[model samples]
Target chain A: MIEFKNVSKVYPNGVKALNNINLFIDKGEFLVIIGLSGAGKSTLLRLINQLIPVSTGQVIVDGVRMDTASGKILRNMRRKIGMIFQSFNIVKRMSVLSNVLSGRVGYHPTWRNVLGIYPEDDKQIAYKALQRVDILEKVHNRASDLSGGQQQRVAIARALAQQPLIMLADEPVASLDPITTVQVMDFLKEICASDGITTVANLHHVDLAWKYATRVVGVRAGEIVYDQRPSQTTKNQFIKDMEIVYGRPIHHDEFVIEEAVV
Target chain B: MSDRIIVPPPKRLGQTLGILTVILVIVASAIFARFNIIEVILGLQRGGRILARMFPLPGWFGPLMETLQMAVTGTFWGALLAFPIAILSARNIVDVPWIRVPLRFFLNILRTIPAMVFAAMFVAIFGIGNFSGVIALVIFSFGLVAKLLFESIEAIDEGQVEALRSLGADTLTVIRYAVLPQILPQYISYTLYAFEINVRSAAVLGYVGAGGIGQLFERALAWRRFHEVGELVIVSFVVVLFLDFFSAKVRRSLI
Candidate 1:
């Protein structure tokens, strides 16, 4: 479980990224955040992992205060919170197996990790993670040799190797094709659902957010404008409310509509 | 329709002033240095006579090999030492100004001391040997490789570093997994470049009695043995050319 208590973030250059954000995320919930670029969605997600320190308020994750956490305590806390990025962030020159194995670096001694000597158990975990993401066949291949979609899957595998209690995704599918987007989102949803992982993702697609999110939270200008579940609101009502979140009517391109294959 | 032609763009006052300033600086420098065209012509004629005397190239096998050995040994140790120094100096790797800034300043100071000067100093201390020559090349190569490597490290994809940190990877672990892979090719290329430069400098290091073909050159020139000096030049030139070509090919494949 995660809790943001009156959380607010202001950059050094006087940009207010988040304002008085109070949100609670429960375990096993696929929570999707939707907003335009620079809407504080990224700042909010990064606060949970302590990548970006909050300007004010407390972010408590599983009873530890992320804002004030330091040294080993912070690292130990971070190891349990897995994150994936829009660019996939996998080392291109390295093998997929190596990239996945890097996820387990926090569990081992620094010297062992530096020498690239992962335990047999860690190797098993890495292989299983790659298997889960259906990239086990390309384990030995250089990550740069893979397509964008495959690279993202490898990144997911890398995060999965952590066996995390929580998963954070920052625009995970912004660079993928429509079909690959659905495929990747499906894998993410299914894995998180089965594993009972707390998932917080920032999505660009309005329709995908509706389809996948157990709870959808809409943000606008550093404020949470809408939060609802499908069972609590009709699809038409959700679309209508999204207008305020986007500050305009949702455009057609905001949704991923898969084209018919020839 | 009027027949209008495109005209050449007029030069701005700043551009014109800059060109004039450059020309004025060159002229002033030439005058200050007392550059003489007649003296240069006379020097060229003397150079041709020296060239005529340097014929039937003497055996240069031993000293050439010694020069190459120094380059190889120096580059190996220097580049190895450069790895840590570069990592410490890189802005992305070591964020603290106290550590990064001072390390960079030290590297700058090291680079400012030419290899020849380093050789001369080492020769004075170590008493004129290949050991001194090797030490000079090592220090020179370390400075060059570290400077280039730190720059490369700073320019790496920061997102990978962020990803590593988010996964709770320690600083060293982050460097190993994220930073090292990205820059390994560039690192190797830089080492090869340093080695190529070291080979040339190693040949000259013997001039300061630091051991190599340069010592042979000095001895031959002092004894008025122009043919032996010519042989050394020819051999060193061929070896340097071959090394540059080979290293360039290897460097190209790496990146």
Candidate 2:
């Protein structure tokens, strides 16, 4: 379980990225945080992993309080939380298998990892993760050689290789085409469902949130304005709630046309 | 649109001509002081006679081989030493300002001294041989290679580095997996570039009794054997050209 108690983030220049927000994410839940650009969706997701440290309040992950965690404890905490970035973040010059193998570095000694001497079991795990993403065929290819969608799949495989307790994705599909976006989202959804890993994703498209998220949380101006289960959400009510989050009425044209078709 | 608003072409042309006149005057003054066309014309006849004497080259193939050997050894050791220095100087890999700053300053100081001066100093201290020449080239190559490699390191995508860090990889692992792979080709290319420079510098290192074909040239000149000196110069040119061709081929394959 991930628990946020009065979490707030104030930047050095004094722009509040997140307000004193309290929330709880149950284990195995597929949660999607939605907002406009710069609405703190990314910040909230990053705070869970302590990627961007919280300026105030406590974030307790599993049993460790991240705000106070330091040195080895902090690293240990990060090892269990796998993060996926919008840009894929795979090292372009490295092979796909090596990029996936990197996710296991935390488990090995520093010298071992530096020499890239992962155990046979670790290699098997990496291969398994690639299989899960259906990108096993590209295992020996350089990350840059793959197309954007393939690279994103490789990124997913890398995260899965971590065997993380919690998966954090920050706008993972924002740069992908529509078909690839849906495919990537389905892969993420499947990973969460099958592995029972708690997944938190920051999404820009409202329809995608409704389609895949079990629970949806809305943020506006650094504050959570709405949080609800997808089944209980009415389309009109969701749009009405978005007014506070967006500071304006949600336009019909902004909704994904494919979601309407479905 | 108004007739009164029409600009005079002659006035604009005069302004341009005035600027051109000033530039021409400066060029003329610089050429007169530095080049002196009349003196160059007067000296050409004497140069022709010297050139006539330099024809029909004598073979000093043995000294030529010695020069090539010196350059190869110096560049080999210099490039080898540059590897660790370059890695330590990378900002992402070496976080401590105390270490990074001092190492960077040391590299800067190494580069600031010309290679010939380094050879001269080593000759004075170690008393003249290929050893001094090799040491000079090593220091020179280290400065060039490390500077280029560190700058390339700084320009790498920080995203990959962050990804490794998030995976809980230690500093060394991050460098190996994230930093090294991206910069390796560029590093090799830079080392080769440094090698090309070292070859030329090594040729001249023998001027200070650092031992190479340059010693032969110096000896021949002292004895007024311009023919032998001319042969050595021709041999040096051929060797340098051959090395340049090989270096270019290697660099082409690396990138």
Every candidate's lDDT = 0.90, 0.84
> After best superposition, candidate 2 residue A57: deviation in angstroms?
2.6
Q: For all candidates in order, state the fraction of native interface contacts they contain.
A: 0.76, 0.64
lDDT of 1 by residue, A1-262 (tens): 9999999999999999999999999989999999999999999999999999999999999999999998899999899999999999999989888999999988988999999988767878887888888878887788999999999999999999899999999999999998999889988999999999999999998888888899999998999998899668887788888888988887655578532320
Report DockQ per prediction, comma-separated.
0.28, 0.24
* iRMS, all models: 15.8, 17.7
Residue runs of model 2 more than 4 Å from their true location after superposition: A260-262, B1-66, B69-73, B80-90
- For model 1, what share of native contacts is present? 0.76
Tens digit of lDDT per residue, candidate 2, span B79-107? Answer: 77876777788776667788889999999
Q: How many Å off is the CA of A133 in candidate 1?
A: 1.5
Could you say which candidate leads in DockQ? Answer: 1
TM-score of chain B of 2: 0.72
> For all candidates listed, what's the TM-score of chain B alone?
0.76, 0.72
Model 2 Cα lDDT, one tens digit per residue, A1-262? 9999999999899999999999999999999999889989988987887767899999999989988887678877888888888888899988888899999988888888877888767777888888888888787787899998899899888888889999999899998888888888889999878999999999888878888889999998899998988789787787677777677887877765375443
